[model samples]
Target: MKKPLLIDLDGVLRIGKEPSPHVEKFFDLINTLQIPSCILSNSTLSTTNDVRQFFEFNGIQTKIPILTAVEAAAMYARLRYRRVAVYCTDHVKSLFRGLLDYENPQAIIIGDYGKRWDFETLNYIFRKVREGAELIAMHKKRTWKTAEDGILLDVGPFVVAIEYATKKEATIIGKPSELYFASALSLFNLELHDPFIMIGDDLETDIEPAKKLGAETIFFNSEKGFTQEAILKANPDYVVNNLEDVIKILKEKF
Candidate 1:
């Protein structure tokens, strides 16, 4: 039986645009051992195709599949809501560009806008919500690590602002929500009992949800800034201090 590894990109393999020190070695081991792997991310900033390019540029040789929240949200909206007013970064907008018409949307979708979160955007989204638009949020992360000085804010605050103004709770589409996970799993044509593992830095979004679905999990402790104590509470199957440790564990287990 082949083991399927679900890997998270940020903090696990790379941070921002740079790859972790031992990420290449880990990929090499996966290739040498012919282990099947898939990349799963909660990022709404890029399309799946763009994510593939990012992995290619970062020296991940496998053409492994990528499943992102942006794609999942767009697909969900297409089936449920005909039109969506997305409050996200320009990068995320590019992901569902042709799929949805942004000029006038029927639902309000919110996510991280980085430093672009302003009163005007908030007011606009609130107005749409007041006009009876449904709310959908990609993820509720409070903050994320950046290449610059300190930690940067996430979409949680922005979602809060809209919720306060509209008096409506937004539907969460990313991790902790099993719908998105099931969607990714469906792409593999694999069974629930299959030997699968989820490796990620964050415990709440990556490890806990995968474990709930009966999959083995690996926790990659990248840095103190982005580390969450909840991960320890989740009790993953394996805990590695860094990306190299993943290779070591895989070698021993497989």
Candidate 2:
């Protein structure tokens, strides 16, 4: 049987607000091959439904399951805390419907606040954490790329700042976190050591964690920054330049 696959959505299938040129063909191959797979995105700004709409909007339709950091964080918050104050963009605030408590919260869930992250706002969150509210970060990605804006700071740096002030680590709920990876794996009823393939662009968040979890890694060498030597030293099982190349690798190998 073909191995289960864990796919990252952002750089692998989409870039910025647009779908990658070969994304449709890649999903088509995955569907034809009937690969047991799950689409994982560390996008705190988008929900699973939003991602589906994106593909549909781009005229590429498929029924592959999706799991985003926002959904996972909501699931995590609901299962643990009752009165939770979710600090995210208005787009995804509804995910934590029943747990929205800003006045007196038992837990503070941080996500992509975008331009709203100022000293006063961060200080408020810091005070809340110091006051005994558990801090849960949606994802700790240091930066993200945009089609127009180049690279911008993500929520990780803010999460780390709060951690620094509070002297406590926030429970990370996205990529590279074992809990996040395990949650995605569980969708296929697969465990950490199960034979699987991970396709992603970011080495730190996507490749490294999956490699540690025993997945055969495929580094999607789409973005710049890493040297050829750096990629080789990271030692992914396969490195492909595009989604077309990814299709080739899967057809030729797994």
Candidate 3:
């Protein structure tokens, strides 16, 4: 049987609001070949359905479900905490539903707040943690590539700052967490021994962790800041320049 494919969204399918030129074709090929795949992201800015809508609007008709760090965080919060304080964007905040209670929260969830992150906000979150709120970090990505703005700061820096102030480490609910990968695989009834491929850009969060889960990796070198030495350290099964090249690999390998 052909291996299932797990693909990262940022720096792979689209950057910022712009999908890559090869995106539509890539999705079509996946559908045509009947490849069992999932669009996985550590992004907290959008939900799985929102990603689906974005892809459809960009002309890629896909039935592929998304697995995001936000979803994982939300799932965890539902089982663990009843009331929580969200230090994320409005869209991400909505994922928590009834659990969101900034007044008196049991946990403080951190995600990408972009410009919303400032002295007052950070201090407030710090105080909350100091007051005994459990710190829940969504993901720790350092930076992300954009279609227009190039590289932008991700939530990692701020998450670390909160940790520094509170002296309490957050329970990470995203990539590099074995639970996230194991959960995704279990949903599809897959085992670690099954032939699988992971195509992503981030080495720490995407490549290395996926490898630990026994997935053969294909590092998509989406030009932000990757040195040859870095690539050597990653040592993926394949290195492809663009999404088009990834299509060829699927045809040849799968």
Better-scoring candidate (lDDT), 1 or 2: 2
Using lDDT as the measure, which candidate wins? 2
lDDT by residue for model 1 over 149-206, one digit each (tens)? 5677788778887899778998888765777666666667775445578998887788
Q: What lDDT, from 0 to 1, does candidate 3 have? A: 0.85
Error of 2 at 175 (Å): 0.2
Off-target runs (Cα >4 Å) in candidate 2 are none
lDDT of 3 at 205: 89
- Candidate 1's displacement at residue 152, Å, is 1.8
Off by over 4 Å in 3: 147-149, 191-195
lDDT of each: 0.77, 0.88, 0.85
lDDT of 3 by residue, 1-254 (tens): 56888889888998657897788889889989998888888888888988898988866788887898898899999999999998778877888888889889999998888767789888888999999999988888888666667678888888888899889998888887777777677657987556678999888888888887778999988776888898898788899888999999999976
Off by over 4 Å in 1: 98-104, 164-167, 191-195, 224-231
Best by TM-score: 2
**Candidate 3: clashing residue pairs, number:** 0
Clashing pairs in 1: none
Tens-digit lDDT track for model 2 on 1-254? 56878899988898767898788898889889888888999988898888999999989998888989999999888888889988899889998898898889999999988878899889889999999999999889898877677888999999999999999999999998988888887888878777889999988888888888888999998774778887877789998888998899888874
> Please, what is the TM-score per model?
0.86, 0.96, 0.92
User: What is candidate 1's CA lDDT for residue 50?
Assistant: 78
